[model samples]
Structure formats: structure tokens, C-alpha cells
Target: MHPPTWLTAFLDLPADEFDAAVAFWQAVTGYSLSAYRGEREEFATLLPAAGDAFLRVQSVESGPAGVHLDLHAPDQVFEVRRSPGGLAYCLVSGTESERPAPTTWEDGNRSQVDQVCIDIPPALWDDECAFWASATGWELVQGGRPEFRRLRRPARQPLNILLQRLDEPDGPVRAHLDLSADDRAAEVRRHERLGAQVDRVHEGWTVMRPPAGPVYCVTGRVPSADPT
Candidate 1:
């Protein structure tokens, strides 16, 4: 199959915590929750007020809470597969074209869940990066930092793709959401007020554990900046 033209990020939550996770995500992103779908109502999309949806949530029957991606390629029937680095992803079809705007919080600071970061073991980094670049047909931009690489996404697409080489030698690849914030500290405080906790602080980003979902990061990147 040809490379995917569009993609949607899925926040896979444990079955018991699904409702709470959805609520937390909605408050953080300012997105409306779509009606739940799938047998047993296991799926839902987070609807942006101004753009086509690009983020979804799944109430998984099994497996720990984590994130995944659905690559939207033409003519592809739904299928699940693992990348070279073992990150789980789906192949599906979609026509999402309008990118959503960054959410402005009550304090005037802005943030957007603009990227999905794939954490890859050091040994598999090269192969994993190549797999994603070929799979998505996006330009792979090498990062200045040795540990990171980026896939340049189309402006109309809602999320950018980033591959991070982990210090570990080998392990399953994992994915997480990344929010670009206009004021990093302010955004962190806002999320904290919503029940999230700071996991760790880095030089340009802070890791956080939302009250109900997988851990993610709040980065110092400007919400309006091009996500290269």
C-alpha cells in the first residue's frame, strides 16, 4: 500500500478508566466528545470546534493504557501492525483535511496537542525512523540533537510525528502525545489545576501524568510555530 496521507492519534485507555480519561482529555484540549462507537461503545473522537477530528480515544479490553496511531491511507482496510521498533499502529482510510487551532486557556496562555512522539530503543532507531518515513511519505528531518528525528507533516494535517531514540538498548516502542505551549510553565499549572501532576522536568519540556490517561509532555515550543 502507498504511504498514508493522513493520520489520527489514539489515546488507548484501560476499560475502567475510559470515562474519566475522556473527560480529562476534553477539558485539556477544549474539544467536544463525539458519540461513543464500536460494539460496547469502546471508541470516540475528540471533536475540535473548528477542524476535522484527528484525535480519538479507545476503551481497551486488554493491555495497559498507552497511545497508538491510525495511518489513513487510501483503499486500506483496517489492520493493525507493529513497526520495526514494535510500536502498535493501525492502517485505515480517512479524509481529514482541516488542522485545528491551538486552544487558548483562561489565563491567555495557549497550547495544542500537536505531535505524537514515538519512543524507540537506541538499537532500532534508524530502522524505525525509516519505516515511519516510508509509511507516511513524509520528509524525515534529522534533529540537531542526536536523540531525536522528525517527520515533516503537511500543514493541513493535525499532528506532527517525532521519533525519539531512547537510552535503553532494546524494548518495545511506545507513543505519547505532546502539547506545544506558548507559555510552558503556565500551561503546566493549568493542567495541574485540572488534576494532572508533573512527572519530571526537562530542559525544554516537562513530563506530566494526567489524572486519568497516559503520560505526556508540555513543551516550550510556541503553539503557532511550525512543527518541524
Candidate 2:
């Protein structure tokens, strides 16, 4: 089954400048915070009604702070800790967290979507398709697939969203998705139960696959370190 649409995340800067940086969003989107961290936090809410979009300011880190993803929620809370009024993130707070593969759903509003597809090596086509399908229990495009494309919409999300047939795994791919496991063993066992294949092992970084064209990477690091 696909993951429920709820929250979305954006990263690239440090926590210190979030309040200041959001000025750009405020200027462009023309929408400002109604709730959330307000003027003192790294992340703030655009509207309490949506309650899922977040702007996470990466702190002390440099060079592509990591991923920018959206999560869905009716509760209207997407936690990011690292700013003026820093409260530990729920995921980082050692609270019960659910392990989810990249998931999405269609609310019939394409403009409202926060997830997108990226390119992958063409050779990974079948494997990537197979892997994601089995892992999330979703279906791949039956045919007429695009080359190096990104697909969204929960009703239709490609396991390997993009495909481009290149040399063996280049650097970490342009961008990669994140997966968090409650604990290392639990992460491994749960993914394993879902038919995921672990390719590399680390105290925290764990690369795995559901079936596979391109190997999907996951990290079972501590709560705060678990970037997804």
C-alpha cells in the first residue's frame, strides 16, 4: 500500500538562517505562517489547515544539506529541530516512528504535490521497478515509460521515478530519498520482511533494495541523524 499523504520537507540551508531565509518564500509564495514555529524557529507553518509543509534549515552542514521531501498529515505537524525555539523533532525525540518507503497519493491537485521523480540509470529499469513495487506494494507503469523521468501522484508513483542508463552508481546519484528505521535490527528485520535486500551494512548507514534497478539507500542512524 502507498503511504498516506501528509507532510513534506525542504532542506539546503542551516538552522540559524531559517527565519531570515523564509523571507524569500514569504515574498514569492505570498503566503506567510499562520501557526508553526513563527518568527523564532527554523521551520514554520504556512497555513495550519495544510499543516505539513516545512522549511528545515540545515545547520553547520554544507554542500547539499540533503533531501527535500513532503509528508502528509491531517494533524498538521512536521517537526524539524534546529533553530530559535528548538524542540527535538518527533522522529528525533525517540518517539514511536513508522518506517515508510517513499510513498504518495493523489488528492487530484497536481499543483499541491510535494514529491517528484528523478533520473536513474537505464540499466536499473527492471530491477528498480521490481524492487519498489515489492517493497511498497505499488504498481509500476505497465508500459510507455519515460527515459530519465520523475513521476509523482500516489495513484501513480514509480519505484525508480527516473531512468538514464549510466555507469555503475555515480556518487550518490544526483539526489536520493531517505528511510528511517526505529532501531537498526528493527529496521533491517522490517524491511527484510517487506522483501528488502540489504547490500551494505554500517552502524547507521544501511543500503537496501526491494527488488531492483538502482539500489535504494536507507540509514538506521539515531533519531536526529536519521535524515529522510
Candidate 3:
């Protein structure tokens, strides 16, 4: 099957912190807010001023705040069938919409969310990696380090999938988006100005916390032209 065309990186925040989380993300990504969704206004799409939305923020009833991916396909059941081993995912219909082309912000930084990294416990690491590989039709390759694995999508796809094996074997699964930037340091500074705290720098990538949101990374990579 052909891979899906749309991908959304979702930030699941604690119910009380939703507003702050949305504000922080909007400032950092320079995206405008789409109309709020859900019964209690628990969902919102973070749309780039000119591009397809690859990010969203949601308020969850419980559990630690984290991230997940929403892959839009013509047949939701087909996509779900690709995932096995109890991966936490759902298939929703009628959620697709048109998006504008991507544009760069005044900071001279064009950001593209090019990767989604799933934090998997040791026991489930292999299975999870395999599932993502099957679901995306992406090749599973070893990452730069042992603890990391990557599901590299075809060149045409907008995002890559990564599986990071965590040392802890008994925690909830979490995910994070990796933004590729032309100038890593400058982008990090820009995000800092928008209320993101630098948690630490690993290798050359900067790990950041957006106000009350979960952590994500800024890496030194050329932003892909296709923003969706």
C-alpha cells in the first residue's frame, strides 16, 4: 500500500495546562490556531501561517503529558491493520482538510517537523519498531547509537519515524516531534524567546520543553521542502 499523505504531530497536555501549552507552541512555531474541537474544547490544530498542519495540541483527562502521531489515510482500517502489538492508536474518519503551502517565519528559520520519535520501553522496543516499519512502509535501520532505531520513510514522505528504546521497562509510551532547522542554535534561541526552556543539548540537537508541554528536539537538518 502507498504511504499516507498527511501527518499530524499531537501534543497531549494535562487538562489544566492546555491553554499555556497551546500558547507556547504557537509562539515557538509561529503557527495560527485552528478552531477548537471536542466537547470541552479539548483539541486544537496548530496550523502554520501558510502550510499544512503537521502539529496539534490536545487536553487529556489523565496521564503524563506527551506526544503522538495522527497519520491520515483513505482507509482508516487498513492503516490500523498495519499496526499490531497493542500500539496505542485510533482511526478517525472525516478529519482531513485542505492546508496552505509552507512559509518561513521572520526569524529566517523555516521549521519542518520531519520526524516523530517514539519512546519505547525495553521489552516492547523490537515489536514497536517493527510495527511502525510495517505501518509506514518505511525501512527500519539502526540509528547512530545503539539505543536508537529509525523507520526511514521514502524521500517523498513528509516525516520519518524513530523508535528510541528506553532503559526503563515499565512506563507509559510517549512520543515527540523533531523539528529540522537550517540554523540549529538560532532556532533554539528563537524557541527560547517563545517560552521554551532548554532541557539539555544532546550531540548537536537541542532538547526543549515548551512551557507546560512535553519535551521535543531541534536538530540541524535542512527543512524538507514538502512541509506536510
TM-scores, each model vs. reference: 0.95, 0.38, 0.84
RMSD of each predicted structure:
1.8, 17.5, 3.2
Off by over 4 Å in 1: 225-228
Candidate 2 per-residue lDDT over residues 59-174, each given as its tens digit: 33334334333433345354543211121222221121222222211321111112323334544555554543443333455423334333333422211233233456533323
| Candidate number with the higher TM-score (1 or 2) | 1
* Residue-level error in angstroms, candidate 3, position 139: 1.9
Per-residue CA lDDT of model 3 for 1-228, tens digit only, reads: 445555667788998888888888777666789999889888898876664566778899998787777777776553333243344554444244444333477866677667888888887887788877776667899998899999767644556787889889666667888888878888888888888889999885889988887889998766766533
- For candidate 2, the lDDT comes to 0.37
Tens digits of per-residue lDDT, candidate 1, 121-224, equal 98888899999998888999987588889998786777889999999888789999999988999999988989999999999889999888799999878886
The residue pairs found clashing in candidate 3 are none
Using lDDT as the yardstick, the better of models 1 and 2 is 1
Best by lDDT: 1
lDDT of each: 0.88, 0.37, 0.74
